[model samples]
Target: MSIKIRGSNAYGHSGWFTVYCRICNRKLKIGTDLVYKCPKCEKKYNAYFCEADARGLKWKCPYCNTELVPVI
Candidate 1:
């Protein structure tokens, strides 16, 4: 079964995406190439792309529980 993504984060083929907070409406900038930090809300999401990552890992928003899926 294919996982469904319901949040504002759109996954692309580039294998990179910026996480956004619906409450804060702010674009999260990638820092340190590891930790995903929300500048405005100061909330950290486990940034995961639904796109084709080598490991085929899955990710969801910690606060909202929105599934991240590929936009294809």
Candidate 2:
């Protein structure tokens, strides 16, 4: 997947934003929000996904079944 930087002044902060999921071409909304980064697939999500729900202790991506690395 590819990552892109999108910026806006909606939150009054100006900077580069890292966006994941190239296939989906998704853009992040401008605001204070939370995201869970998947290590293997390098995907981002809005909610907390448990390892069990993600299907293993390896912290894999729920969408691609690849191991996920948490970014906080």
Weakest lDDT window of 10 consecutive positions for candidate 1: 49-58
Write the residue-wise lDDT of candidate 2 on 1-26 in tens digits.
96654456444443445443333444
lDDT of 1 by residue, 1-72 (tens): 998764455454222545543334444434422323223223344343322331233344444545443322
| Superposition TM-score, candidate 2 onto the true structure | 0.30
TM-score of 1: 0.22
The positional error of residue 49 in candidate 2, measured at the CA in angstroms, is 10
Q: How accurate is candidate 2 locally (lDDT)?
A: 0.44
- Candidate 1 — which pairs collide? none
